[model samples]
Target: MTGAKELDRFLAELTTERRLSPHTVSAYRRDVGTLLEFCAREDIESLDQLAVHHVRRFAAESHFRGLSPRSIARRLSAVRTFLAALVEQGRLTANVAVHVQAPKPSRRLPATLDADQVASLLEIKADDDLAIRDRAMLELFYSCGLRLAELIGVNVADVDAADRTVRVTGKGAKSRVVPVGRLALEAISRWLRVRATLVKGDEQAMFISRRGKRLAPRTVQARLNHWARVQGSPTRVHPHMLRHSFATHILESSGDLRAVQEMLGHSSLSTTQIYTHLDFQHLAHSYDEAHPRARRSRRRRQKTK
Candidate 1:
């Protein structure tokens, strides 16, 4: 089969059988597509002709082109998945990417907004419809700690105003019920009233675009950047930052790791444990500033005495 045909088949299987999200499917397509390009350059046409060396070289080239280790690892994982699927389907005998390993991605701490920063962003009022919609989205993002895809995928029926809980479909098509802050619920209620004025069709989407259609992830990102600037944020705020803030703030206040894991919908406690490091960092900074034994604090206190 041709490379494109194979990719199409694999993607169809991903959607129908694996039930993977579109974002994940696209990432696999791009990674496997890059492998095909490398095959063409190396004069290899068939899946049986692929070798572990070629896969390693592709990883090397990606690194040479300045791709991050995490990105390279993700690309390798995609190629590995594709090759494994082909083997399972009797299309190939050996997996080319099985032996090719990517570098371990460095674990960087998540960035979060302080409570004051969040309050300022959410407190700003919206006069226009677009701004009103954006305000609702912003509130929901922090209120529920939703992933970008989950937030955009929310429908009118997913929200229960009386319960103050929203049903969000997350990664792997898993649904979870999460609480919504009163402010976010109020903002959503306001947007629902003005929503009909903008929507053209019988769209069930909770957040509609200016064209009266479902909102796009890119549009949400662009709006977030705009609002970040307008709100005088030091850096351009993104959706995941809001999620990080939600996790960090909640963990700091409650210190209940299990509760936070449920709220964030993490399948593993280890996955949710990253926020504990963030919480500790916050505590260390506070201690440094408030404690007299710290170098800076000791110097200041001695000078004052």
Candidate 2:
């Protein structure tokens, strides 16, 4: 089979069988396309002909072409997946790309808003229909730590006010029920009251446009930023920032790694550990309060004073 045909079949399987998200599939397509280009340049007609040296050269060339370590890593991963598929189908003897290592991606901590900033951001008055809707959206976002896609995909039935919980479908289409804070629940209740006025049809979406369609991801982002400006925010507020704040604040206060992981729907504890990094002042306070040596040192300083 032609390499192109092989990629098409793999992508189709990824879509239907694996149920990978569109963004993830698109990325795989792009990264694999780059590999094909490299293979063409190397006079390779089939991925079955690929060797370890060829993959090494491809990685080196990608790095020389100004691809960042993280990007190169992702591309390598895509190539590995494609080759592995080929091997599974008996197109190749082994997956050569597996031996090639990608550089470790730098771990940049996610940005988060402090409690005061979050309060200021969420203090939108429900004076109008759109305001009520936006208020509900913002409240749910921060309250639940929902991904923008997850928030956009919320249905009318997903939010259970009686139970004070929301059923969120996260990455990999994994669904989890997370608690809804009182403020978020109340805001949603208010929005539900006036929601019918803007809805045009039997839209089951929890958040809808004036035309009564499910709210688009772009619209959610624009609305969030628009409210941020109106609220006189210092920085541009995105949906993920609210999620970051939710996780950070929750971790800081509760100090429960496993709990935060479950609430965030993170499949790994390592992903949740990023929130363990507290502000320097918070760290200092913790040290002073919890460390026996620090307490003795403080007592000595106090005696000297």
lDDT for predicted candidate 2 compared with the true structure? 0.90
lDDT of each: 0.90, 0.90
Tens digits of per-residue lDDT, candidate 2, 1-305, equal 23788889899999999999999999999999888888888889887788899999999999899899989998999999999988888888999999898766677888788899999999998898999999999999999999999999899899988899999999999999999999999999999988878777688899999888899999999999999999999898888999999998887788788989999999999888888875444677789988999999999999999
Q: List, residue by residue over 1-305, the lDDT tens digit for candidate 1.
A: 23777889999999999999999898888888988888888888787888788888999999999989988988899989998999999999978788788877778998899999998877656999988999999999999999999999999999999999999998889999999999999999999999978888789999998889999999999999988888889877889999999999999999999999998989999999999999999999889878868867679888999
For model 2, the stretches where C-alpha displacement exceeds 4 angstroms are 1-67, 71-100, 278-305
TM-score for each of the candidates = 0.68, 0.66
How much is 154 displaced in model 2, in angstroms? 1.8
Candidate 1: global Cα-lDDT? 0.90
lDDT, candidate 2, residue 204?
88
| Candidate 1 clash pair list | none
